[model samples]
Target: MLTRILPPPGPARMLIFITMVMSLGQGLWIAINAIYAVTVIRLTPGQLGVSLGITAALVLISSVPLGHLVDRAGPRTIQLWSFLSLAPLTGVLLFVQGFWSYLLVTSVQGLAYRAGNNARKAMIAARVPAGDRARIRAVIRAALNVALAVGACLAGLTLAWGERVGYQSAILLTALCFLVTGLLTLKEAPVPPVPAAAGAAFAVFRDVPFLLFTAVDGLLSTHGLLLDIVLPLWIIHHTDAPRWMSAVLLLINTAFVVAFQVRAARGTDELKSASWASLQGGGCVAAACLLFAMTGGAGLFMACVLLTVGALVHALGEIRHAAGSWTITYDLAPDHAQGQYQGAYKMGVDIGKMFAPALFAWLVIGHGATGWIVLAVSYAVLGAAVPAVVARGARSRATAKVAAGGVTSSTVRM
Candidate 1:
């Protein structure tokens, strides 16, 4: 019965598959970037943090503009360009000597990364059937996480060799992976027609529900960014862990995501008022971050184990949030405005990625552990608050309109 009802694996599935493979390369590249910046480029931790923050900020600035370009040009072009550009940039990293050179190379890499992400998601939305979009997204996320786990292991092996050789090999491998993936994407169909203008493309600002969703999503992204930067650094620098512990810690997080994400999103087949679930997820992440802060003297293995448990809870929240958010976007977006809406959605995501590092860096420097706890608490409060307010407001506004309209009861549009 389930088999009969499920959509055939065709264009949408193929796109997801291809993109997932490409994303594996992206995952591998990002997982070890901090090590490379510190060991190979000879940058201080503070400088590396700032550099990463700046790159992310640039991506944030470029996301909407790139989205508009995708709408005007085509996702295929943008995706292809992004991949090809990454290949050369990774190769050029070998020659980067000074701080100025490092900054220039990283800035370009940021542009490619942002453009690739925007083009990829927009293509999936355009190409995939509406009904199965959420499931497809979940599957892609799970696959991407699994790939990242494998990539992190590989990166560890390379680093075990020596910093310079290891970093060069990883970067080159990533470049090749991008080259191949980008080329395959050339076979993709052109962008589909969107439904309507729905006002200006940027008019997503006027929609209150979307604004709230974007804000929550952006804030949630800080947790994810920390996983990349802070967690591993802590294991390496602060704890009495083996050098390989960073890779092991990542595997735990990715393994949980790969294993449990589907189950986490079991019944969320349609978009509805899910602000409660969103808050729950956010709260879990904030709590995990605080737990992460509390650990002091355990061995690397035990510390990683605790972190893994926290990450599992966090991953569950992440899956639900991803599924719910996409479902909402599909439900709320007017047809012709899908591209614009997607652009708007991505803009919110980028904002989170952009600010997380810079904001957290300052906190870590100024307040130390206390600062970390304060930031965690603040995020937790915001996480729990936004969804509750938005969900309740949606319900009240809906109820009031129904009451004003004479005797009949009616359901609100999700």
Candidate 2:
């Protein structure tokens, strides 16, 4: 059973193990950070918001440069240093007293986290076979979700304990997780750095088709905020469903992803299939939005049913979207520049998320069903456009190859 679910004993399995450990730490931090900031640190909600915004901005600013560094310095070496940096940075969170200190610590932590993530993706590109990359990513994501859930449960226990010591302990434990992940990274074989040509450090920015696809894909990725931020508010304020149903919805989404994500990822190794998966996934999410909108003003039983069904559909979309996005990002990038390309993709997603909370609050929570309809339409339109966008990217790559000289077999297929 373990073999069926996990990669064989090799670098891929090692990577998955590292991902699980890292995600466990993130899960603990994410679950309790806001409460710690508000209650322990005595920061107001507005101050917390500012800190988060600044941290995100710092992540955006640092992503490309750090990823470029990963390419030049080697993925394994950069990833080890990034993880080591995170250990101290996260530990410093235990000492945050006010907004400024909190902001400074978290901003640095975010940058280190982004650098580690970019290097990890590049490592996968370097180590995993092309045919297995998407599947392995899906497996890693599944492991991540499971580990995060476990970590969140651990955080919950700390919250229930209701002591300053418990919170501090969780922070220390998360720091330890980072340290362990860094040490574990040492076991993986070293990946050679891809030397970059002078004046071509940021060439990915010039790939217009890739940038466009990243933008559209980033917009679609905002569906996550819908589940995390929008749904809880919608259930509590608008729908007749019980508040606990929100937790239930999250459980359903997590379980479905763990069970089906690898299966959904199958066949996404190719551009055409991956594009189709994105379209289909988008349609499912759009349908889920419409379903969720209908829950407004519904009776308790009817609302519960709609929420359950919508959650399942949303999870389906989530996994498919993830699989397709991984493939597209991997395929679109050149072998030598995977780190920077992945960083660009991460930047796009982060930019979308930065605005998603406010946007969803205004449109979905503020405007109610109307907001939901707008989101549905946006997802559907964007999802339908993926195929064309992918084709255009393929054509552009092909043109570049031909212009350079004779087209490669891969270019001919594109």
Candidate 3:
């Protein structure tokens, strides 16, 4: 089990270690930042929301350009500087006294985070072999999950202490994590920048099929919001499950991902298999949504059972969706432009993050069971549409290849 969960000793292992450390800080910050903002920083809920929203918008706007920078500057250098930049930005959070200052710090931090993230993805593309990319990504993700859970627990302790010092300690610890990760990144083998071609810097925008696929994948990615934002509220307002069940459901989801993400990624190294995984994963999520809907007005025991089962099903879908998305993103991107392409991929996810919370709140929280049904149908439609979109994208690429002369090394399996 350890061997299966751990990547082989090499660059992959090193990357996983970096990811774990990064995610540990992220988990700590995520769990405590809102509370710290509201309680310690004295920001109103609305102010906090505005700051985060603006930060998300900045990240979305900056992702592609930063990614292009990675392609031009080399992944290692960009990643190192981006990671190093984060330490000071995060440390500055300790001194933010007003909404404007908070917003400024967070916005810059968000862009730094996106840049580092894009560089890391490009590094994976450049360093990892195609056959092992998805599997290694899955392992990294599993490690991330475990590390996040541990970090969250530590945050829980800090929160329990209920002192300003504890809050500051968490912030400092997070900043230190960023610093350490940045320094550790220096040990990674340097990846040379891809040679620039005319009109290549922003070419991802010209790929209509890739854009459509990104949009669809972005929509599918909202399954995360469904789990994190929607389900807890559903349990409270719409179902008879105990309030504690929300935490239990989260535990189940985390445990399942840590255990099964690599296993789920086994067959997704190829586009055909990855697309099928996406479809099947969507179906599982849709089924879970239906199960969640059935929990409304149920007996306590029945609702508990339904919620537990739905969480497990959702976890299965989450792992598969993640595995497929990674593989498809890698396979579809041009070899010379992985950074920009990954930036585009991150843009899709950032868009989802910006809009998904409000959308799910209005849709599921406002409409109750009917909202869940609607969400289920939407996921089903989106999942069902993935194969067609992938097929279309593949055909367009093949056509472009033929026009260029014949199939080249960049051509992927149809």
Work out the TM-score per prediction.
0.77, 0.97, 0.97
lDDT (Cα, tens digit) per residue for candidate 1, span 1-414: 223323467766666667667777777787778888788889888888778777777877676676666665667788889888888887898888867788889999888877777677777777777666777777777777666666767787877876677788898888888888788787777675444343565655676776776776677656776667766666555555565765555566677777666556555554443455556667777777666665445676776666666666666666666666666655455434455567677778777766677777666544556755876787678766755545543564465446656332222234
Q: Per-candidate RMSD vs. true structure? A: 5.4, 1.5, 1.4
Which residues of candidate 2, in runs, are more than 4 Å off? 1-3, 405-414
Candidate 3 per-residue lDDT, tens place, 213-291, comes to: 8999999998988778888888888887889999999999999998999999998887778888999889999999999
Backbone clashes (count) for model 1: 4
- Candidate 2: tens digits of C-alpha lDDT, residues 1-414: 235889779999999999999999999999999999999999999999998988888889888888899999999998899889999998888777888998888888888889999999999999998779999999999999999999999999999998999999999999999999999999999999998955577878999999999999999999998878899999999998899998999999999998999999998888888888999889999999999999997999999999999999999998998998888888888777899999999988998998989989999888999999999999999999999999898787778767767554452243
Task: Give the 10-residue window scoring lowest on summed lDDT in candidate 3.
Answer: 405-414
CA RMSD (A), model 3: 1.4
User: Against the hidden true structure, what lDDT does model 1 obtain?
Assistant: 0.68
User: Candidate 2 local accuracy as lDDT?
Assistant: 0.90
Q: What is the lDDT of residue 108 in candidate 1?
A: 92
Question: Which residues of candidate 3, in runs, are more than 4 Å off?
Answer: 1-3, 404-411
